[model samples]
Target: MSELPVLIYDGDCGFCTRSVRWAERLPVRMRILAWQEADLAAYRTTPERARHEVLWVAPSGRVFGGAAAVAELLRSARLPWPVVGWAMSAPVLRWVAERVYRWVADNRSRLPGATPACQLPPEQRPGHRHGS
Candidate 1:
């Protein structure tokens, strides 16, 4: 029930943690929750939905996903970066963002987390327990 915006990220990913720490330093006051720490049981955000992408919940109750989430993050940053958010929201800019997000998502498992070298197909099943 905190009134501030919320940034939801993967708590166990070191790279993601570093990014969140930078966002936490932004001038705008906000709230951050690692998916591992957030109690999402009551929310509509299903486990599958929660694990696939980053989430940004605005104080006004707007929820942004994927690229929009990134833009929301930029908007919350100090200044020049806020401009990046605004620009990112533009039609042409967002198209590119979408592609960027897709590429990242496709390789998210490799970013950092416990896992086999890469996620395997159902047939292969990366037997290791760690996965991004």
Candidate 2:
């Protein structure tokens, strides 16, 4: 079989860690790694980027973030899920999914299974402007 893609997530964030656990239950086989444990350079990603959003790194070193990463992950799953993935990748749904993903990431600290560590630093949160 070919190599599986790598999924990078924040290990310190309880919500993200729990979400990774949930993804592990899926039939698809991929390397789900905590960003803290993975070689970010190998994945062609950075700590800041990984801290800001979930990441999907293809075997070729291509990277996708946020909703796009979620779509790529779903596309790798078994039946019904790939279909959902396709839908999410569609133009309209893709836009909506991006917004939803951003909202979730921005407020994950308040969500179930989240710990105080789940709260991203203010600069890392979405819509945070540099030099503001």
Candidate of highest lDDT: 2
Candidate 2 lDDT score relative to the true structure: 0.84
TM-score of each: 0.75, 0.87
Count of clashes, each model:
3, 0
Tens digits of lDDT, candidate 1, 19-111: 678777778677788765666553335435555677887877677877899898898887798999989889999999878886876675577
lDDT of 2 by residue, 1-132 (tens): 117899999887888889999888877789988887777877887878987899998877789999999899989999888998999999999999999999999899998998865676745644344543
Where in model 1 is the C-alpha error above 4 Å? 41-44, 109-132
RMSD of each: 4.8, 5.2
- What lDDT is reached at residue 77 by model 2? 92
Please give the TM-score that candidate 2 achieves against the real structure: 0.87
